[model samples]
Target: MPYDGFKDVKQIVKGDLEQYIIYQNEEVELKKFDNFVNLNDVLNEMEIHLKAYNRVASIQFYGITQDPETHSYMMVLEYEQMRIFEKI
Candidate 1:
């Protein structure tokens, strides 16, 4: 199912494309996609059973272009510019 819950598609499209680290803020080389994959479909597939630790301000999608062509796409989620206090 598509990530229909997100009312705005622009949230993912507007952000700039850059290398983003996965959990624990570690940087790793990832593959990129070509031929224009659907943004919503990619997001929805990724969100399955994913947990959010901090407040999310926006989500960004990026394409890791390559010469040999390995993977299809890469998605990045950006958090809001605010402090998120843990509910201790």
Candidate 2:
């Protein structure tokens, strides 16, 4: 599925640069970026999990936003079948 944009980033908290959210099936998946984690690392990790459940279709980075309140960056990831699945 094509990235619909940042329409999924629910909120941005201050002082935390590693936390983000993924909206799926009327639910939210809270995710954290480990210290020094890069975009490629995140994608690889997600790919493994998606493949485990046979839900892998496509994945992409939707966007990145800096929270004015926290000055932290939020990275949004978009997925195809995985997002549509009730469980991931």
lDDT for each candidate structure: 0.32, 0.42
Local error of candidate 1 at residue 74 (angstroms): 1.6
Model 2, span 1-88: residue lDDT tens? 2133224555443332223444444323333344424656655655565465454445454444444444333444444333443343
Q: Give lDDT for model 1.
A: 0.32
lDDT (10s digit) by residue, model 1, range 14-71: 2222232343342232222345467566555445412342234322322222223433
Candidate 2 colliding pairs: 14-70
Candidate 2 off by > 4 Å: 1-25, 31-33, 55-88
In model 1, which residue pairs have backbone atoms overlapping below 3 Å?
A: 32-64, 33-72, 57-80
Off by over 4 Å in 1: 1-26, 29-36, 52-71, 76-88
C-alpha RMSD (angstroms) for model 2? 7.8
